[model samples]
Target: MLEIQFFQKIEFLQHRLVAVKKSVMVKTRKVFKNLSCLTVISYKFKGENIMKRCAIVTADLQNAAANKHAARIKAVEAFLPEHTEFLNKMRAKGIPVVHLQQIYDPNDPRKYKHTDYDKKFIEGSHEAAILDEVCQESDIIVQKHRDSGFYDNNLHDVLQAMNVEVVILTGMQSQICVQTTAADATFRGYEVLVPSDGVSATKPEDTERALDWMQKYVGTVKTQKEIYDDVLAGELIGGKHT
Candidate 1:
């Protein structure tokens, strides 16, 4: 009878050990499953949180009726209202707006005899100064020496500080200053958006050609109305106010 009782005790102890081992195995599997699920959730959340950057680049819009043709001035004047509205909307949304003013130094080594009319105008007279009517006190102004705003300018640094990833280009001489800046921005890995109505050239044909080229290579060309609507819809980089 004593021997039988001892064997029964040994059998009961073995059964308890087996049950504990099974419980540990089940808990370990559950922990591994939870860790895998957390890893996937982390990746999905990161993918959905990517942010975008945006800015506006305006060229010198000075009054030069005598230097430029009367027709050119008329074109610029016609576009002013629309441009102002667009800029105001951008400002309201807290988007960065950069105005590029052309400046020239008589003694600067970069000046050349056959430089473009835009460059020559800056080098020669007061017409290079940005037109006061278009520039507001609140706008950020950047002075540029060449066609491209980035050339010898702190535009890139400023954009970097602002975390700008996309540039919405506008201003005078669509085929020259605007195009040059857009191309340079593209080369520098920035997305560019040129509103068809926000920019104008010396002639309609020039403007069309520039837009075509930009659409083909440099950046996306959109209409001002489209962008404004996007702004209103709260679909742009900055949240919509109205």
Candidate 2:
């Protein structure tokens, strides 16, 4: 009887130990599950708060040479509303806007290219300045030579400093500066968005051709309204207002 009682005691202790081990495993799994939930919540919160990395590049919107071109005037007249709204909205959203001016410096190798055109935006000419109506005080100015705004300008540096991975472009001479800049941005591994109504050239057909080329090989061509909605939704490069 003594031996039997001793065995029963051993069995009872073994069962108790098994119950304790099972309880520990259950608690461990619960802790791990809670930790996973916390991690997911943290990730979502971080994403929600992070701002988007994008910049707006407005190329060659200066009044100088633009004033001499009848086609440019007509093109701009049709889309001024879109340009105005987009510029103001970008400013309100605190997006960095780069205003590109084509200042044909006399010493530039490309100066010969502009000899046939009207004289304006000649390096330091007041006419080289962007239109007062479209410009806000917060805008950054980048004076460039030739058709591309990136030529001899601080555009790349500015974009890099802002950590911009996307460039939203608008402004004059769609077939020249705007289109060329869009292609260059794509070559540099940046996604570009060109609003169809936001960019213009001396000729409407020329502008459309440039837009088509960008859509095919350079960037995404969207309407101003679509761009505004996406920007508001935080679907573009950086974060939007919460």
lDDT of 2 by residue, 1-242 (tens): 00000001112454432111111112243543434221111111222434356788998777775576676677777877778888888778677788887876666655456564535667677777788878888788887876877876788887887788778999878888898899788777677889998998778889988887776555679997887787788765442222
On a 0 to 1 TM-score scale, where does candidate 1 land against the true structure?
A: 0.69
Quickly count the clashes in candidate 1. 0
Which candidate comes out best when scored by TM-score? 2
How high is the lDDT of residue 156 in model 1? 85
Q: Number of backbone collisions per candidate, in order?
A: 0, 4
TM-scores of the models, in the given order? 0.69, 0.73
lDDT of 2 at 94: 70
